[model samples]
Target: MIKECCNKIDNNKVLLSMAIKKKRYEALVQVYHSELYRFAYWLCHDPTIAEDLVQETFLRAWRSLESLQDDKAAKPWLLTILRRENARRFERKQFDYADVENNTLEDNKSVTLDDEMEQTVIHRQINKLSPEYREPLLLQVVMGCSGEEIADILELNKNTVMTRLYRARNQLKEALTDNHEPIKGALN
Candidate 1:
């Protein structure tokens, strides 16, 4: 009888724990959805890709939610998930060299915005850079991650992250300062 009673108590505790986990997941989805969406949007310029990235991020986060301890670190944790999702997406999709080269050669005026033309201009220029340069910039600018955090997300050494970020900024500055007339040999 005692053994049976202990088993019943254990089952009840498991059920209660499950209920709490569900509630926390729901609350997390509510609070971080927008931030995740925005981060994904900047990662991929397309809204559809952003939605997919955020969805994947949340799905992974849900699976690993038990490992997460600090609620305050949720934002960075979510960002890390999104970045990994983005990388996995590229790996699974399997881009051809021709396709990648062709894409890099394309013009990127699509990054335009109404209110902040100059900033938009700079953004488009940044967008034009190869992903090696673009990823770190977005992590820093859009996601507000520190250098070490960016390094971890991008899976690079801290020095490498710093170098790429420096190069990205310098390239953007040059693009912005270049003559108003488009460069003669812009890829696209």
Candidate 2:
């Protein structure tokens, strides 16, 4: 009877460990996978590569899951992994830049020509922003990360992240205003 009890306890311990691992992985994927993918996509500007980077990031995270000591650190940890994965891509190979004609930026299906033109202009202006300014803004707007989270992810101070966000907004406003003034003048 004692032998059977010992076997049961051992089985229960094994099951509990497996369950913990499963929950951690599932929770990580459920919470951060999309955000990580978006961050990766903005970094590389390639959907396929972004998907691969997120996959690799999560794989690394799963391997080191126990090292994550704080719940709040998960997002930044995942983002750091993703950023490293992106950097490693450059180390592995020197990729040729894609030709502009081959780039397939999405076109919003709008019935009005003005709406389509407006979206195109906005997208172009965003693409024009330097990486320093662009990345923080992407983390805020796309991933919905707070300034502190962005700072942690980007390894910048919170003030720096705020400054980048400010500059990014100002640059976009100026670009749009400059573009629209000519159109308004023509109408008048």
Number of the top-ranking candidate, with TM-score as the measure: 2
Candidate 2, residues 66-129, lDDT tens digits: the string is: 8999978998889888888888999998787664222223534544666556655665677789
lDDT of 1 by residue, 1-188 (tens): 99999999999999999998899889989998977786777666666777999888889988999988988777778888888898898888964434321122113456434324554555578778899998898888777878988887777899999999999878876776674544333322
Off by over 4 Å in 1: 69-72, 92-116, 179-188
Off by over 4 Å in 2: 1-15, 100-117, 179-188
Weakest lDDT window of 10 consecutive positions for candidate 1: 98-107
The local lDDT score (0 to 100) that residue 87 gets in candidate 1 is 87
Cα lDDT of candidate 1 equals 0.76
Model 1 lDDT, residue 49, Cα: 76
Q: What is the C-alpha lDDT of each candidate?
A: 0.76, 0.80
TM-score of each: 0.74, 0.77
Question: Lowest-lDDT window of 10 residues in candidate 2?
Answer: 179-188
